[model samples]
Target: MAGCGFDDLPLTRPGPPLNAWGLYGEGDEYGRLNLITAQTVQAGLREAKEGITINLNLPLDTMPLNPTRAPLRHEIIHRTHCNDDHVSFNTQGSTQWDGFRHYPYLNYPEKQQYIYYGGMTSDEARDRSNHRCGIQNYAKKPISGRAHLLDIASFLERHQRSPLSYFDASTPIDLETLESCAAESRVVFKPGDILIVRTGWTEAFFGISEEERQSLPHRQKRGSCGVSSDPEVLRWHWENGIAAVASDAVAYEAYPSVNSPSIHETFLAGWGMPIGELFDLRELAAECKRLKRWTFFFTSMPLYVNGGIASPPNAQAVL
Candidate 1:
């Protein structure tokens, strides 16, 4: 079946709410990613006219942002006058792409029953024997396509003459604000385009003192400012044919979501769309402003671990 409108969701029989289970195909791991066809890639390549490349990943050592995750560890091994390095860290310690298995819908809240994309269960995702709906699926065909940036922070400062006072949980970038930003920037949506939003979360995180950084995880209210989890946001993403969405915020959507079935569950599990978080978009945003262009060629390759739930996005943008 062709990609249906957002109103025609819940394509599969007895499926969860706002799902696109059978839109791509049964047992299909790649959800919106399938939209990045060869033609789409070729079109993206055309955006590399200036021969400039910008790295979109934050340093691996800039991790342990979440207290639950282990800190990055690096060790050096010396042998025969040669040196080798061994590294170990959480795939999601820094910038990362949340895979299909990363988030699952709570189908039966009473019994705590969870369901992943394409009707895969949590147990199925945990079983390493089968690599269904894993990050490796993305590795098989790396995500590469034209990307559009909605510079929300910059837009507000330039046009509205009022910038965000704080980058925290209290702040929410609503759909209307995002539309206004895009309109002010003259960005036109296109099928198979990777949508990137800059919310200034990363900049705020790094701007504080080292003492404050150390106290982040221990804080009782550790919420991030990001896109709103309103159903209308999902409708906009589906209607625009966005293959994936990335942002500098810790969570692509406001952390501790105000709505049920957060963007993580709906996008990652329902639509099979990847969600990138903690991306370093400061440099990219500066370049976009310098060039006065919001579109670029975006590419990302995740780790090839079978049954992997998430991985750092080795991403780049060419213009």
Candidate 2:
């Protein structure tokens, strides 16, 4: 069980489909993150030959992309000569890492029974004192590893001569496209590597006017381009030893879920893998193309909120 492959899934008896519940150990809080060992850290450090650092977080003041989430609020407190500011907003309102408790698998659709990672029930996740699989676990260790950029949009335009209809279109970036992009970039996958993909979503969002941006949430039939949530995609990720995945898309998977048991359910709830969404990858992509190097040292530290479901990805990449 300690060295199981993708074929040896459902480590728990009578577990959810494609689950690796006990792969790390019973009640393991750090799911696939367990792959980031000292050796992996050393390997990641080797990628930082150049001293170029790129910020991967969108501005905290960026307009709320999700309609359900409230816009960021900031209030300046006047303290004579010194001014203090109080800010509050949803953790997932911008670039964020979806923790194990953020998305749960529906164990019984009829009864709407949902379960978090390590078999944590909704009640356990909601308990104020319980922190079984909270984002704090990640905050304690943080996430650092060698990351490879796929630049899917660039690949499609260059290779297939097919540009995406729109960043908000319901386009699916399949496994073949991913593998092909990696091959072209000469990025060799390694265990504990963080996969960062650029779908031009964030770049396109910035291209629109503020009025249009304000109306994004009100649009009808709006869809975002992202990686396909097909079973093979999950298998490929597990087989390739990807520790985590991030994208510029809203959900990190095609919105509205084209498949049963969406990637969010399997990756976050079943496998305990973090899903980073809305990461500002435009500058990173440009730098990677300029340097002709897609691999870089990536690091991220989430907020230390006990029993929190998600947090802003205070992430950066060094090349």
Candidate 3:
């Protein structure tokens, strides 16, 4: 658990996780992503034993949009006698990756402290001329690497644990729980690895009738579950050389944070880590159980929109 070597970057200096701003060099859009080296991708390629591919995306618009926000307005126009069509929908209406621009470093204590990675301010983002940290940087060259699937839900089920209710606000999967599951899976992690965790919340959410599911907004809550705001969890990730982390949960961190400096502050803001959420893992987890292996070659393609903040990851796992 030395440092991320961010201090070694040309424009960066030593700072305990706070100054990764210039780690990959000032104006660096691909922060921790730089960890995905040639060796990392090669290792992922080596894991494609049978070339079996699994798609990991939930159907878009499966539930009506939250009434507070406009519903996903989708429309398809067909050309007469030409067998052609055009369609449009929100990029984040389904599975997605929260990009570098999605969050800012809120831990800055100064009253006028408005800064982001590389010490850039929100004003920088306003200038459409320079969308430096936009998610498009990853899209221009999609993500491909080893994916470690930590099936937290199934692990709990096999042990006959009590039911985990996502709507209950306090159920959180912390580092120790994650380690227990990883050890059970017998999978070893490597640097630059893309991690995926399944909480079973998505399945339960989708199983309810559409009417019941949509009623979530009325209750002023959504049935969600995620990793706890445990510093140890973040430390473990950096120390293990994880490139990015994703989950089959809504926020990827518990809905109601139990502590300050939530994972979002340090991860997305501090280390420039990528966070993917709401991915469908029921099928992939089943495959991992059947094959007795949890590692696979993971690939994801976000829409190649210029300067976009976030986008759906048409993610897939090849085992």
How do the predictions measure up, each by TM-score?
Answer: 0.96, 0.96, 0.89
Model 2: residues with Cα > 4 Å off, grouped in runs: 107-112, 165-168
Specify the poorest-scoring 10-residue window by lDDT in model 3: 7-16
Tens-place lDDT per residue, model 3, 1-319, is: 2254433322344322344666566567787888887888989999999999999988766453345533455565667755554445565556888877666666565525545555557777555677777878778767789889999899889989765677656578878888999999887888789989899878888788877777876765553578887767766776688888899887788866676566666677667788887889989998999999999999988887676767789999999
The residue-by-residue lDDT of candidate 1 on 1-319, one tens digit each, is: 6748888887875777788998877778999899999989998999888989999999999956789999889999999899999999998899999999888887645326898998888889889887999999889978998998999888777776555534344466788988998887788888899999998878888899999889888878787777888989878988998999999988888887888678988999889999999999999999999999988999998999998989998999999
Candidate ranking (lDDT, best to worst): 2, 1, 3
Q: Candidate 2: deviation at residue 300, Å?
A: 0.5
Q: What is the C-alpha lDDT of each candidate?
A: 0.87, 0.87, 0.75
Per-residue lDDT over 183-219 for candidate 2, one digit per residue giving the tens place of the 0 to 100 score: 9999999889999989888878889998989988877
Q: Return the number of clashes found in candidate 2.
A: 0
Task: List the pairs of residues colliding in candidate 1.
Answer: none
- Residue-level error in angstroms, candidate 2, position 66: 1.6
Q: Quote the lDDT for 319 in model 2.
A: 95
